[model samples]
Target: MRRATSLLCFLIVMLCGTVAMAASPVNADGYYKGIKLCGRVKVVEHFADIKVKVVDSFPDLRVKVVSSFPDDVGEWQFVEYGEDFTVQFVESFPDIKIKYVNSFPGVE
Candidate 1:
């Protein structure tokens, strides 16, 4: 009985660790300075990523990096790393979706 109980506890711990590792590292409600470009992503200017200036209202448009892109949503194109953009935190899934463009939108 003692051996069986010990084995069950060890298995439970291992299972929990696996589940935690499988989840994304991005916080659902925290500001993010950069994201790993798992898929294509639009590279914006440094200031553009800041949450205060970018997010106009509540429920800001921040996002976390997922292992795979969503089938229903669009994908980003440009390649940018580090704090090139700042993202406002959001309280939902599918944080942000964008399509690649040849030029910046609304710029002449």
Candidate 2:
């Protein structure tokens, strides 16, 4: 019985984590732009493809950028200026990743 209870607790926690990871709200004309770390300078890997989407889930959007040279890490913020989302900044380099998943109803 104790083992079963422990397993149930673990499963619950895992489910919660998954939900949180995918908590972005749905937007039909929404877009997300982010940079992903391909590899270190010594590794020399190409940047991941820039992803653009509309009427899709946030998880489906994977925007990344890579370069041969190293970039400084920083915080990235995305604010809904008009009808599109934009890459604001990054908190770190070689591992920069951001997701924009909502629209400002009346930002005009």
Give the per-residue lDDT digits (tens) of candidate 1, residues 42-107: 344333443222232322233233334421121222344533233443333334432233333210
Candidate 2 — which residues are off by over 4 angstroms? 25-108
| lDDT measured at residue 97 in model 2 versus the true structure, 0 to 100 | 32
* Model 2, C-alpha of 12: deviation from truth (Å): 0.1
Clashes of each: 6, 8
Per-model TM-score on C-alpha atoms: 0.33, 0.28
Q: How far is 101's C-alpha from truth in model 2 (Å)?
A: 21
lDDT of 1: 0.38
- Reference-based lDDT, residue 29, model 2: 29
Q: Candidate 2's residue-wise lDDT over 19-56, tens digit each? A: 86555432222322333222231211233233222222
Candidate 1 regions exceeding 4 Å error are 25-34, 37-83, 91-108
Model 1: residue 69 alpha-carbon error in angstroms: 30
